[model samples]
Target: MIGRFKAELFLILATVVWGGTFPVISELLSFVDAAYIVGFRFLISAVILFPFLFKGGLFLRIRQGLVDGFILGSLTFSGFYLQTVGLNYTTPARSAFITQLLLIYVLIFQVFAKRKRPTIWNVISTVILFIGAVILVDPFALEGKLNKGDIITGLSAAAFAAYIIRIDHVKSEGRMVSILFSQFVLCSVLGFTLSFVQDAPVPIFNFTSVGFILYLAIPATLFATYTMLKYQPKTTPMRASILYSLEPIFATLITILFLGIWPLKHEVIGGSIVFFAVILSEVSPLLRHTTKPEPKN
Candidate 1:
């Protein structure tokens, strides 16, 4: 029980670290292109985690790690690629919300895996939260304007949602460091490869950009990936996901405090709705399973 709680706490801390990264990366974009950001972030992360990769025997689980790494890294790298490109068109806050649509995706995957339909409340919660996101994003504003950034961010959201599902498969097969280190290395290579198509600029070794890369690679990629790979498997996907959904709440606060970006009232309202809905889904299951009636006379 204590172990489970510790795992959950680790997951929560990971989410907090990730949520806090938005403003930093958003600021770094002034000095760095998105592809360069992705590549360099993973490069730093790979550097940090590479030494730990061999703590367990290199080939003791080489075949499994490689297989898992390729598949997970491919999906993860694709999500980052789309997201970085998408950010070229969107607001950081909107991008954060969109990426978190993975919560819904995770729940849906669990439903199918269980071979049972989600409860009516579950469906209702999903719809309510999704609708809340629409309001939060507020697409109809701008006085006869459709934002390309928002659309691109939306697409990235879907891509990331799918990637979260793919990650679950890889989490089960190998050591976390080995798998995550391989993932960072592969993703760095993959991002570099894709950057060519975009005519990515040569990296400039600026202090601010380098610092951002280090933060992203270490806390966001390395630590967060390790926690997700290690902990998500120990809990139900829905539970893991709901805890993860806390990212948006944290992001909003960080953005407001550190980035000087104030959320619209509607965004706060919508995010609250989503937060409550997630609580309902995750807590209800645990309550039902754990609560017992008093003994009959």
Candidate 2:
């Protein structure tokens, strides 16, 4: 019981870090191109993780390195690419709601890949969550015609879902360290390469952009990735999936408190629906554990 709580705590912290990305990236928009922002993020993250890569002769575990590398890397990088670029066109609420479709995608992928059906509670919760998301996004409030950014952000959610699914495919007691390193390497190489290909402008050396990049590189990339890789397998994917919903909530709060940004009434109502849905889904499992019969002495 204590262990589970600790794990949840770590997951929450990871979610908070992820949530922080919204504002940090929003700030960086003034001085850095999205692609270059991603590129530098991975570049610095890879450098920070360099010591760990060689600590255990990481390359020696190379049976599926390349395959896992590209698959996870592309999924992770493409998601960021889509979300960051998409933000340029869409409101933050819309982008966050759309990106969060990955939660549903994760559940669906788990069902097919693992041959496991969702419990009744899972289905109910998912529906509730969707309602909340609709409220939060306020689809009617969209700025422009459904454009390339919206499509790309939606596609990015799917890609990120694929990445999470692949994490399940690579079976090991916990090869998380190696797997993460491979992912970082691939992301760094791909992002940097694409930066050049896209003719992304060079990032200026402003204190704000540099600080934002560092925050993203260290806490968001290194810490959150490490936590997810370490603790995700301990809990059901459903639980992990639901916990991630907290990201948008935290982001919303941060935006409100610091930036004085507030959601519309409908958006708030919708978000509550999504929040209730996730809680509804988890209540059954939580109750079952609490109410189960005691073991015989």
Candidate 3:
């Protein structure tokens, strides 16, 4: 139990680091092209992780390590690229609501992939979690046709969901380290190659852009990726996704810190609901364990 919760804690921290990206990237896009930003961030991450390629030679042991990493990497890059571009087309609330759909996707996959129905509480928690995300983002307040950004962000959610499931399916335990390294390598290639192909403007070197990229490369990219590879499998993919659903709440808090924007009433209420949903999920498992009959002497 202790070990599981520790893994959960690490993932929570990873989510927090990920949450910081919204504000950081929003600021970065103004000064640097999004493609350039992606290119540089993942390039640095891949270089740092290059040493791991030789560690234990796990890549060789896990025959599919590079393949799995490529799949995960494509999903990762797609999620990021779509979300970044989607925001330009959609409101933040819409993007939040859509991205949080990733949890549902995982649940859906569990049903089909495992052929196992969710427990009652799992369903309950999922419902509550979804409601909380909806309330927090409050897409209903926006008056317009469903735009490209909303659709694009929803696609990003699917990509992210696929990424999470792939992590669970990785063949070798801790072999995901190799897979993650490969993912970074692929994203780095895609980032730079795409930037050039798309004719993105050459990014101006500045303290702001450099600082943001460095922050992203290490803590957000490397640490966060490592945590996901190492810790996410400790819990069910759905539970991990539930915890990840907190991304918006963390993003809201980040806005308060960096943009000085206090959350509106709806955001406060929604954040509370989402938090309660997470608590319910954590407690449900414990309650089940405690309720089991005692073993015979």
Clashing pairs in 3: none
Model 3 scores what on Cα lDDT?
0.76
Q: Which portions of model 2 miss their true places by more than 4 Å?
A: 1-7, 61-64, 110-119, 142-151, 172-174, 229-243, 282-297
lDDT (Cα, tens digit) per residue for candidate 3, span 1-297: 888899999999998888887777767777777777877888898888777667666547345467888888898898888887776665443455557667667778888987868777778878997787667666776774445676778788888888878767777665756776778778878888888899988888799889989999999988887788779988887688678868777876786688676766876787677677766765677666787889999
Query: What are the per-residue Cα lDDT tens digits for candidate 1 across 1-297?
Result: 777888899999998988887777778777777777888888888787666656566666445477677777777777777777766666566667766555577667677764557766667677876887777667678664646765666566666766666765555544666666667778888777767778977776678778778888888887887788778877777768788878877877888888788877877776677677667766666665666576799
Give the candidate number with the greatest lDDT.
3
Model 2 agreement with the true structure over 135-248: per-residue lDDT tens digits: 665556657344555566777888888887887677644455556667777787877788799998887877778888999999999899789877877777767867887877
Q: Where does candidate 1 stray beyond 4 Å?
A: 1-10, 55-61, 107-116, 143-146, 171-173, 227-242, 284-297
Can you list the residue pairs that collide in candidate 1?
89-149
- Report clash pairs, candidate 2: 132-270, 132-274, 135-270
Clashes of 3: 0
lDDT to native, each model: 0.73, 0.75, 0.76
Cα RMSD of all models vs. native, in order, equals 3.8, 4.1, 4.3
TM-score of candidate 1 versus the correct structure, residues matched by position = 0.82
Kindly give the stretch of ten consecutive residues in candidate 1 with the minimal lDDT sum.
Answer: 167-176
